[model samples]
Target chain A: MALVELHDIRKTYRVGDQEIAALDGITLSIDAGEFLAIIGPSGSGKSTLMHLLGCLDSPTSGSLVIDGVDVSRASSNQLAAMRNAKIGFVFQSFNLLPKFDVLRNVELPMVYAGVPAKVRRERAMAAIERVDLLHRVHNTPLQLSGGQCQRVAIARAIVNDPKIVFADEPTGNLDSHTGEAILTLFRELAESGRTIVIVTHDNGIAARLPRRIEMRDGRIRVGVEAAVSATTPLISPAHPGEEAGA
Target chain B: MNFWFGLLIGLKEISAHKFRSFLTMLGIILGVASLLAMFALTEGVARGMRENLAASGGVERVEINNKDPSEENQDLAFLSPGRTLDDAEALRKGAPLVSLVSPEMNLGNNTAISRSNITIRLATTGACPEYLEVGKYELAEGRMISQIDVDRVTRVVVIGASVAGELWPDTPDYVPLGEVIRINGVPYRIIGTLAYCESDAAKRKRAAGFSAVQDERRTRRMGKKKRVNRYDTYWQKNHAILVPISTLFNDFRTASNADGTPNWKLDRLSISVADLSLFEETLNQVRGVLERTHRGIDDFGFDTREEWFDNIESSVRATRTSGSLIAGISLLVGGIGITNIMLASITERIREIGVRRAIGARQRDIFVQIVVESGVIGFIGGILGLLAATGVIQLLIALSPAENAPVMTLSSVVVSFSFALGIGILSGLYPAWKASTLDPIEALRYG
Candidate 1:
């Protein structure tokens, strides 16, 4: 059985008198340990799909099954628990809490998990060490550089030992060298049998993943497809003309 | 999530905007401070009034006055002899609750007492040895008029300090105690001199810190092992002479009926009880005896003196209640200020809230965080208010009139501080709820 399964999922958002479909009839399944990317232009519902997969939002219709539990009927608290226990998220803006030092920021997920202080401190230190940011454990996010802040965010995401990790335009705010370093870290984690999902409009980033799903106008353009090789370089950047290939 | 974690988050938020947090807490600070001050002042007022009543012998004594039976019933010219010497005797014998019964007859104010060349017209009260005990009067130089004096109808008197000064200008204060003075051409020996007297105004000034000499004397007396009577030097205006009731009835009984029989009469009757708890029962028993002697006409009336003290206490209690109500309202307004500030904080920290939620914070966690933040604001405000109230109370104790000075107790501090905290929690609820219920997706997307 897949680690996550979405069946004919549709999400409609109302803006005054109009009805807009953010996710329309989307069906996808993610196997354990799969490195995948969902790619699209802005307004193609790529971000919405990321939100749904992360259990941050529920579908307006159809079913979402996470670890064989139907989450479409689950309460908000259960979604929070699933997010805490099974999933980790990295965002483009590197959303580390402004007041928390690196160690405290990384300890947050476990804090919500009700982990004891002694254990949480040890695990958080270990996670920070993984990102090579142990030296700056007491430095707040405001005191860190952009790349360092993103690394701190990554340490926070993986500190709880989540089964899967989600990155939404994780390298959008970093320089090429820093962006490359982050991608290398994600690749190393994926090689260690942790499933990873990246959402981006950047074809350059998507071509490196093992699996790809291309979306256009709230619908999947390429459906689910496996890469021919591990180091495939590029398909094309997201553009209006790319939809003609469907 | 742990409570300390919430508190840490709260402290961080408060420190980040120190000025804004102070502004938010100002209302609670003023409300709580004023509340404490009002409570202390009202308590002081009640306590002072109680002391006044206690000093005047109101708490332990009841007064029964005679009323003419013809005043109540027009059909009867005379029903029974009213509250007289016999009623006092009956109450003293039958009423076990009573500790002392003192009957008094006013020998007209113009009565003259002369010692050699000095003749002074002084008002006299004819009473027994129990008068000094029931009225709580202390003898300064010599003994009081004894039971033997009343029993033998001896012409003896206890003179007040003023009377002593009037009779002997050059003689020492001790000379008047044993000196014989002529009253209505009969020589009456002065057996005792009542304690020195001061008016209420003078005592008020001393208590208000106007008289340093009095304060020094007060402190010097405190070192003694014997308990000095504070009531002895309090606001009593003593200027009368005391004689035995039996002697007054024998020599000064002037009123008579148509048959020329001496009417057994008394101007007033004072009864003192052993305990305040038994005072009402004793008053009821005296009333019962009086009613039986007067043949159930209900012509006689009594005064417990509680009504005077009770009026002061009730008014003080009312002031305290109203003070608390106003203070509560101000705290609520302060709580509203906190709510407004909290809501603004939630709006400002939307992204932070979103980040926390994405990291596995449940709705309850967010709720606790915001509530704790508000509670911290209140807690700080309560502490600040306590400090400010203490300063204000100390200043009042230094500057205000002694009767008006506020009294701060430990319980008042605890209650006021807790009330401030309660206001904080109550005000924080709505804003915290609003923040916790926000959708993480929308919050993260918020500008």
Candidate 2:
């Protein structure tokens, strides 16, 4: 079953007297362990889509089923619980609590999940260790390098062992090398069987992901190769053989 | 999420801004302290007044005086002829509400001599045993005058503490039990010493000149009367001496002629009513009966400690009004201080509030947290204010004259602390509510 499914989702925001269509009848599905990148230019509604998928917001209309649980009709509190329990979010700005140390920043999601303190500590420490920030556990975000802070953000995202991780320009603030290192972490998380959806406009960043979904003017563009099936033998061979035979 | 954690965070935040927090708390502290101190002073003053009244006589007792216009112009000798021992006896028997009726005949120009020859002006009065109860006099030593003493006209007297100290200063351990003292050159035995009245000093100040003049006028008015040279000298510490009515009348009574004919009758009577609750009723009844017996002579007026107390209360109320006005101003200033501090705190923590809301903290949570923080600061300030008030009370007590010193009561502490806390909460409400209702998005965007 698809880990996440959206049925004809629609979202509209009232900017003054004008109604802006942020999401328009977009139907999409993604399975577990898929590393998909949603690529679009600014004002293309990709961030809004990411917000809905990450459970930070609900679609204005239509049904959304996350892991087979209908989330479109969920209450705010329920959505918060869902976000804390099943979804991890990585913001473009690496939104680490400035007052908290690296370890505490990583442990925050588990804290929100009401995990036992001892268990949260162990899980957070392990997550920090995975991000190679164990030595910087006591250093606040301001004290950490850009890549190190992004790693801490990733560590926080996965510390609760969420079913899906949403990254919105997770490498936006970092240099190319640092950005690559963060992308590697996303790939590692996806390889560990977590569903990863990244939203970014960087083509290089998008190409690195296993599947790329192009969004334009609140709708996904058609006529592109189905990136998810590109690895399957039938599609790759059929496309190349068709071209050769023609 | 846990209460302790929230409290710890709050404490840490408060401590981080120590001076600001202290400044915030200052309003509450001054407000509470002023409230407590003012209340203490008011309570103390009330107590002092009550004590003074009780010493003069319990507030319930009434004094009935002969108020005859005809008698007003009469000489003391003739005036005494109108008031008789019968009036006292009549009040005791006919007035059911009157518990006890003691007729007091004050003798003027008397002298008391101690063993050391110290002469003190005597407060010589002749009354029955009920006089002591009506006057609220406790016998510190020896015994009070009894009915038999009055009937037999015993030459016995009770000395006040001041008089006893003056006459018996050298006798370190001497208890003036059955000691003999000279009254008007006549030897009278000292039977009792009255306990120290709380307002003895005030009475001394009031009586310094007036009492001596009154005595002289009484003496002069009783022309050619057998003037009892009964000296009732009240000491400085022990203000007055009491003598049996018979002794005051017999030894002090003067003759109009050398032939031993009495010059004037002892007619003036002072009646002290028992059970002050019945003072008004008894006074009316006695007045009615006396008016009837004296043939419409409006020669009597009833006086009670309540009248004096009313006068004192009015004066005290004026002082209290001024005090409360001052305290009100102080509280207003304190409240403004609280508002200012809370507004500043809200401004400083806008971002923190935004972050908390972003993390799923509800507006109600934000509201409660701010209010709780303000309340906690208020409570702490209240405690400190109480301590400050207690210190002020102690200082006042130490510095005040013993007789007029005020006391701090438990009610004052509670009232002051609660008022301060209420002020704190009230002052904080607007600022805290303002802070809580800020839009999360806008707040997050705030610098």
Candidate 3:
């Protein structure tokens, strides 16, 4: 079974007596260990879709099965628990708690999960080591570089060993080299059998992933079969034999 | 999620905004201080009054006087002549509530001469042994007049401290015990000297001087009727001699003396009740007894320290009302300031709340966290306020005159501190509630 499944998902928002549809009857499924990118321009409802998929919000009308659990019907508390135990999120702005040190920021999710202090410290340290930020673990967000702060945020997201990791424009705030390094980390996480989903407006970031799902105006442009092109190698240089359009 | 953790966070927040926290606590501080200070002042006054009353006589004692309007209009002749030893005996027999009763007859006399020939006019009262207890007198030397003295009409006397000093100035160390003194050229043996009646002695002296001036004014007002009453003048000057009641009857009574001596009678009877709690009941009972004895004349009236004690409630009430008004205003102002600051804090922490909520914090958790933060501000403020009030009270006590200084007790500190803490918690509730009820999505969207 797919790790995340959306069946006829819909989301609507009320804006001053006007009902704006943010998602319209979207259906998708994501399997385990898939490194997927959802690409769209601003106001294309890609962000809204990401929010629904991350369980930060629910679909107005649809079934959302995350790891075979009906997420759309989950209570607020259940959704919070699911987010803490089953999913991880890394925002574009490197949303590390400004008052917390790198290690503390990484330990936050485990803290919320009521993990024992000893285990939380061990897991948080391991996550920081994974991000190559173990040496800067005592530094607060303000003291860290942009890339380093983003790494801390990523470490915080994954420290609880969540099954699915969601990155929303995760590399948008970084320089090209730093952005490439982040994408490389995502590739490594995916290779290690973690299901990684990246939402980006950058085509370069999207193209670097193994599979791409293009969205426009709250609708999928590439069909599901073509979108999951597993045969295609991620981060591959263009083949000389194939034309650019083909 | 842990209470200690929440408390630590709350304490951190308070430290982060020290000045704001202090201002919020200011109300509690002043409220507690004023409360304690007012209590101290009132307690001091009550204590002073009790001491004064006890010195004069026991607080439980009551004085009863004749209610005759005719007696009021007349001179000492009517007032003193109407009361007699027979009437005193009747009261002793008739009154059931009285534990002890004594009859006293005062003679207006001025001529008192010491063995050394020094003379001073001192007020004198003729009494039995029971007069010692009724007057709350203590003897410095010799013994009070005995029943034998009354029975034999012996010329034995107890002199006041001032009288003793004036009469025996040459021998300052001598206290006149078992010595002879002459009053109106008649010799009497000094039996006892009074102690701790100095204040009353001084007051009597001033009253005598005042009455003399008033008597002179009265003489000027009435030209023909202004006969100089030597007995009245003598009573005004010599106000410190006590003799047996029988002696007063024998030497100074109107019927006994052929020289037309003024009538010496009891004008008033002072009753001492056993228990203060029974004051009203005892007063009513005494009034009923007296009325029955006097044939429902309604000429006499009853007064009690009950009224004085009751008056304390009103004075304390006024103080408390004013205190409460000031405290209420301060708390209201403090509450408003705290709410404003907390609302700002909540607004600033919207994203944090959203983040916490998203990370599995229950609604109750959110609520508890915010409330805890606000309560912490109040608690710290209360402690600070308590310290400030204590310092103020200490300073006030230090600056006060020695006679009126108040001692601050532990009860005052506990009361002030708890009151301040209560105010803080009470003031912080609504704002914390408001913060806790925000929608996570909306909060996350807030700037």
Candidate 4:
């Protein structure tokens, strides 16, 4: 079964009297643990689709089901709960809180999720160790290099054991060498049965992922659903929630 | 998020921008301090007024003073004899609620009580023994005027502390109770000496060992030897010299009447009430008796301490109202300062807020964070203001006259501190709302 299903989702914004469609009738789906990439130039609605999949926002029309739960009509608080329980996001700028140490930044999602302190600490530490950043857990974001900061952001993303992890140009701010290192980390997370989606204009990153789709203007320009089914094998659902902070 | 955790974040936010937070809290601090100071001052003044009321024979005493005859009664004014010993005797006999009647003859303000070459000028009164209670006078040594003395018309006199101090600065141990003292060229024996008059504040000051040189300089400047009390009312009571009314009539009767029966008119008639609740009734009864004694002419009016107490209460209330207005404005200004800073602070933290919201923080969570931050600022400012107010109250106590020392009460502290915190929370409303309503998508994109 598909982890995320979108049926002709439409999002429109009225600029004065003119209505602009940012997402116009895009349909997509992905199985559990499949590493996917959405690639397009600026204003191609790729970011908007990523935002929708991350549950940071809702579509103006059409249905969106994530992990078997309907999300298109969820309330703001419900959207937030969905995000906390099933989705995590990594930004192009890392977006780690500047005021918090790496460990605290990683533990922030669970803090909002009302996890107990001891469990939050243990899981946050485990996430940091998985990202190979346990040594720098006490260091603030400003005290780390771009690659290190991105790793901390990833640790934060997975600390809540979300069903899906979304990265928007996650390596855009790092050098080629460091970018490859972050890609390797995401590949390892995928192999561990965590579904990963990367939004990037970098063709090289898109080619490296198991499945890739391209969008133009406000619609999908290329569909690789058939290509992905032929080349990639489906992963058995792991749920990540059981081992979370255990 | 729990409020405690939110407050922790708020504390961190404030600590990250120490200078801005302190400047923002300055208004609340000053407001609380000024509020506390105002409460203490007005409260202290009210207490002082109450003390003065009790000192001046309290609410139960009534005095009959001269009043102009009404237009209709003006024709019969001359026919009436006026407030005299006869009227005092009639009130004593007729007014059932009249506890005691003290008829007195005042020897004008310019009278000089002299002994040998030394003399001190002060107002003197001649009265029966009831003046001891009505006048609130306590005899330290020697005897008060007796009925026998009034009947014999003896020229015995009782002097106050000031008079004794001036008349015999050498005889400190003895009051010269049996010794003759001259009053306006007439020799009179000093039969009593009054105790020193001072207020509780003055007593505390003396016990605390106040600056002796300043007190000495003040007394020296006033040309008095031993004036200790800060209030002149106390000095008036201390400097008194009382003699028998019969002695005053024999020696000084404001030039005997045309028929030569010795005017017989009294200068002042003070009456004490048996029960404080029936004071007005007793006063009416006294007036009725005096009206009959004075032949139905309205040549006298009544004075009760109730009017003085009412004036004190009203004046204190006015002071509190004005003080509260000023302090409240300052507190409001403080709250505005908090609002201004919170708006700017949230504006600076928009991206941070976005990141938080993106990580599953609800709008209410963001709102609580901002409001709690504002409350933290107010709480700290209130604590600092309380500390500052303590020093301010102490300074007030030192600066104000001893009789009216400003007091810092527990209620004022609680009230001011609560206002500081309440202003803080209230000020956060607009800014928190604005921050919480920010679009998560746009906020994440904001610089």
Q: In candidate 4, which residue pairs get closer than 3 Å at backbone N, Cα or C atoms, i.e. clash?
A: none
Candidate 4 residue lDDT tens string, A75-146: 989988888888889999999889889988999999899998899999999999999998998999999999
User: In model 4, where do residues sit more than 4 Å from their true spots?
Assistant: A116-119, A226-246, B142-154, B170-179, B211-218, B221-231, B254-261
Q: Would you estimate the TM-scores of all the predictions?
A: 0.82, 0.76, 0.76, 0.90
Q: The CA-based lDDT of model 3 is what?
A: 0.69
Rank the candidate models, highest lDDT first. 4, 1, 2, 3
> First chain of model 3: TM-score?
0.91
Give candidate 4's error at residue B45 in angstroms.
Answer: 2.7
Write down the C-alpha DockQ for each prediction.
0.75, 0.18, 0.35, 0.62
Model 3, runs deviating above 4 Å: A73-75, A115-138, A187-193, A224-246, B35-59, B65-88, B102-263, B275-296, B398-416
Model 1: residues with Cα > 4 Å off, grouped in runs: A223-246, B58-60, B66-87, B93-97, B105-126, B137-142, B152-233, B237-267, B273-285, B291-298, B306-313, B399-404
| lDDT of candidate 2 over A1-246, digit per residue (tens) | 778888778899999999988887777777888889899898888988887887657889988999988999887567667777788777677767676789777877665566778898999999999888888999989998989988987888887788888888888888989888888888887888889999999988888677777777887655433464532222224332111100
Better of 2 and 4 by lDDT: 4
Q: Mind listing the fnat for each candidate?
A: 0.78, 0.02, 0.30, 0.56
| Residue B89 displacement (Å), model 2 | 1.7
How would the docking of model 3 be graded? acceptable
For model 4, how does the per-residue alpha-carbon lDDT over B40-83 read when each residue is reduced to its tens digit? 99988998888777777778888899999899999878999888
Error of 2 at B325 (Å): 6.5
- Name the docking class for model 1: medium
Query: What tens-digit string does per-residue lDDT give for candidate 3 at B259-320?
Result: 67656556446666766777777767766665554444445555454565567557756865
| Candidate with the greatest lDDT versus the true structure | 4
